[model samples]
Target: MNAPPDIATEAADHVRIVLVGTQHPGNIGSAARALKTMGLRRLVLVAPQKFPHADADAMAAGADDVLASALRVDTLAEAVADCRLVLGCTARSRRVQLRELRPRDAAAMAHAEAVAGGEVALVFGRERTGLDNAELQLCHAAVHIPANPDYSSLNLAAAVQVLSYELRLALLGAGGEMPVHAAALPAGAVPHAALEGFFAQLADTLEAIDFHKGRAPASAMRKLRRLFVRTGLDEKEIRLLRGILADAQRMARLARDAGRA
Candidate 1:
C-alpha cells in the first residue's frame, strides 16, 4: 500500500497549468509556450474565450504540444476534481485567511510540498478578474508572482512560465530520488487491475439494485480511470481505500452468518 498525494511528496509532474475563463487568445498561446519551456505538459483551460487554433498557436512557437494536448473543460471544478493539491496564482492578496506568498516563495513551498507526499497543482485564473474568492477557496494556498506591488499584475502565461520555470529548476537540482513521502506512486497511473476491481464491485452493486442498463463496463471504466489519474493517488491511499472496502465485505459476511445462526 502506498501513501496518497498528501501535502508532501507531490512534485512538478503533479503540477497542472490551469487557465480559468481566459479572455484573450494570445495569452493562451503564450501560456502554452511558457509551460513547454518549463517542462510541463498538463494544461487545462476552463471555458476560454476562444480556442481551436487561436493566435495562441502562433505564440506557442515549437511548444504547440502544450496547446495540442490542452484539456478544455466547461467548468473549473471539472479541471481540478482529481488533483491532490490545489494552488491559486494571484497578484492581489486574498480576502480569506489562506496561505499566500510571492511566486518564488510559493514555487519553493509548492516544490517542498511535492517532495513530501503527493501531486500538487498551481492554478491561474482568467485575465481580468483573476481567481475569484470562490475559486481561491478551492486552493490550499495562493501564489503571487512578485512584481512592483505598485503594479504586480502578470499576464496569465507569464505567471505560468514563472512558476513552471521554478519547478523545472527544482526538479533538475533534485539530487537522486525525491524522498519517498508516501507509498511509491502507483507507477504513473492507476493500475488497470485496481480500476477493474472497483468497476466490478460497483457494477455488481448497481445491478443488485437494477440500475446499470447499457453502459459498457470497459468504456464506463474509462471515466473512472481518468478520475483516479487526476487525483494522482500514491499506492498507500489506494490500499487504505481497498482495506476499508474489504472490511465492509467481511462485516457483511459476519452479519449473514449471525442471521443464519
Candidate 2:
C-alpha cells in the first residue's frame, strides 16, 4: 500500500546494478548519476560497449565518485557472483514461464531480500535488445516497468532512473541510520588514475593475446574497461592484479631476450 524507502535500510541493503552489454557510455554515466541520487553506491558493469570515457565522467557531474568506484566484469556470470538474488529487466512479456514483476513490485521484493541479509542485484540488458536466454537464465526473476504498452521502448538510463527512484523511496521510508561513506568501502580502495593505468596495460596484454572474440582492439579495450570499472576494486585487489600483469610482462621479456640470443 505504501512506497518503498529512498535509501538503504542498512548498508547491506545496497541496490546494486549489473548492466549487461550496454552500448552507450552516456547511458552508463547517466545511470551512475541516478544511482548516486538515490544513495546507491554499488554498480556492476558487464560487457559494455565503452567505458572510462571522458563523456561518462562529464555526464556524471557531482556523482563522479560513483563513476570512479564502479565495478566492471566481462561476463554477467562474474558480475552477479556475489548476488543471491538477481533480477533482470525486460521491456516485453515472454512466452516462456518466468517470474516477473512491475518496477514497484520488483523494488519492494528486492528491498525485502536485502533486509533479510541477502545479496540482491538488478540486471539490465543492452539498449537495443534485452537479455538473451543465456543472460536471463541467471536471474531468479525478471522486472518489467509498467509503461504504456503502445510505446514500450524506454531508454536505458530512463529505465535505470525508474528503478532507482523506487528504491530510493523504499529505503528512505523504511528508516535507517545515516549513510556511512568513509567506512563503508573496503579499506584502501584503488584510486581512479591508477585504475586507468591498469586498464591501459591490461588492454595491451589482451591485444597481444587476441582475447576479445574477434572484436577490434579498440572496441575490445573499451569493453574491458567497462568490465573493470564495475568491480569497484580496492587498492589490494588492484595491486594483486597489477602484479599478475607484471609477471606476464616479465615472462614475455625473458622470451624475447632468449629469442634474440
Candidate 3:
C-alpha cells in the first residue's frame, strides 16, 4: 500500500537535503538524483567548490527538475536558517561525543518532525572531512550510517541515498510504526539565524569580560557553542540570554573605565 496522502505531501514539502561545502559538482547532481528517487524535492547547496558545471547536469540524469530548483547559499547556517530540526550526517568515530543515531532512526525523527509541521534539514558535509565540530554543533543531533566497521567509508551521494530511503520508509509507515517525540520539541523555536546572532554577542561579551585568559581561545568558544546548542533555546530564551550578555558587556566596560580613572 502507498503512503497516506498527507504523509507523502509532508515528506516532500517539509524536509530538505542540504549539502555543505561540497567539493564536486557531480556529487551535488548525484545527490539530487538520490532525493528524486525517494520523492524528496527540496535541495540546498552551501558554498559548493564547483557548481553549474556541465558535469553536474550530466550526472543528474533525468532529475533536472531537482537541480533546477536547488537553493544555493554561502554557508550551512544560511542553508538551514529556518529549519527547526537539523541533523548532521557524520562518519566520525565513537570518540566524538554527540548524540548519534543510525540512518533509520535519524530518518524517523526527521519524518516525525516534518509531519508535525516543522521544517527539517538533513545536512551532509564535505566529501573528504564530513562536518567539522562547529558545523556539527549547529545541528540538534548527529546521524551515523552503520556501515561495516572495517570499511565504513561511504560516498556523499550514497549517504544521501541511504538516509533518503529510510526517510521514505518512515513517511510511508513501512517497517512498523515510528515513534514521534512531540512533547520534547520546542514550543516556539527560533530560526538558526537568531541563534547565530546570540553566539556573536556571546563571543564579544566573553572577550570583554576576559573569560578566555589564554593565548588562544578557539577551543573554549567551540565548547561554549556546543553547550548552548544542546539547550535548544527558543526565541524568547535567546532574547533573554542576549539581554544578559549586553548587561555584562556594559559592566565590563564600566570596570575598565574605573581602572583607568
Candidate 4:
C-alpha cells in the first residue's frame, strides 16, 4: 500500500533544486540521486557544461527519472524567474549583501514558502568558483553550509545532498503543519520575475530623474536591491512602487522640457 500524500510532499512539489554553471555531468547525476533520496524531484540546470552524458547517467544510478526530467536553462534568472523564494547555496558570503541562512533555516524558509503557495528554489553554483556576485544578486538569501574552517571545501553533489536532507527533515518534522516562525512568503508576494522587472524599471526611472547625480549607479542600485529584497515586497507593493516611479519619471521629463523652453 502506498503512503498518503501529505503537506510535506505537496510542498516539495513547489520547491526546485537549481544548479547553475555546473561543470561536471557526473555531479549533475549525483545531485539528482541525492534529491531523489530525500523525496525531492524538481531539478533545474542552468548552463551546465556537460549534460545528457554517459557519466551523468552512470552516476545517477537508479535515479534516472530525475535526470530525464531535469530542466535545462541558459541562465540563473530563467531557472528561478517564477520562484517567489530563491535561496543561493554559497560556501562563503560574497560582495553581494544578502541575508545569510544556515541550511536548516533555509530549508524551513523553503518549506514555508512552498506551504504558502509560493514557488521556492534552492540554487547551487559551479564547482570551482561558486556563484558570482551577479548570480548571487538574484537570490533572496544565501544558504551557507558550516563546514570545518580548516577544510571547508565541499563537493557540488554533497552540497545539494546536505540541503536536500535538511529540506526533507524540515518536511518530516512539520507533520503536515507549516513550520513555526519560518517566515513564510506572503500569499501576495510577487514572483522573482516581477521583482526583476520592477528593478529594471526603477533603474530607468532613476536615470530619468537623475538620481545618481553624475555618479555611477551600480553602488546605489545594489543598495536599493538589498533594501527592497529584504522587505519581501508583494504584488500590491510592487505595483505601488512602480506607479511612484512612473510619476517621478513623468515629472522629470516635464522638468527637462520646461528647462529647455
Better of 3 and 4 by TM-score: 4
Tens-place lDDT per residue, model 3, 93-183, is 4534566777877877787778778789999999988888768867777888889989988999999999999988888878356544422
Cα lDDT tens digits for candidate 2, 14-104? 5588888888898889998988877787888998889988788877878888888888889887777666557788865453234667676
Best by TM-score: 4
Q: On a 0 to 1 TM-score scale, where does candidate 1 land against the true structure? A: 0.61
Clashes of each: 19, 26, 0, 0
**Which RMSD does model 1 reach against the true structure?**
11.0
Q: What ranking of all candidate models by TM-score puts the best one first?
A: 4, 3, 2, 1
For each candidate in the order shown, give its overall lDDT on alpha carbons: 0.65, 0.70, 0.83, 0.87
Which has the better TM-score: candidate 2, or candidate 3? 3
**lDDT score at residue 137, model 2, on the 0-100 scale:** 54
Which parts of model 4 are misplaced by more than 4 Å? 1-5, 174-188
Count backbone overlaps in model 2: 26
Which scores higher on lDDT, 1 or 3?
A: 3
Report each candidate's C-alpha RMSD, comma-separated, in the order given. 11.0, 11.9, 2.7, 2.7
What TM-score should be assigned to candidate 4?
Answer: 0.93
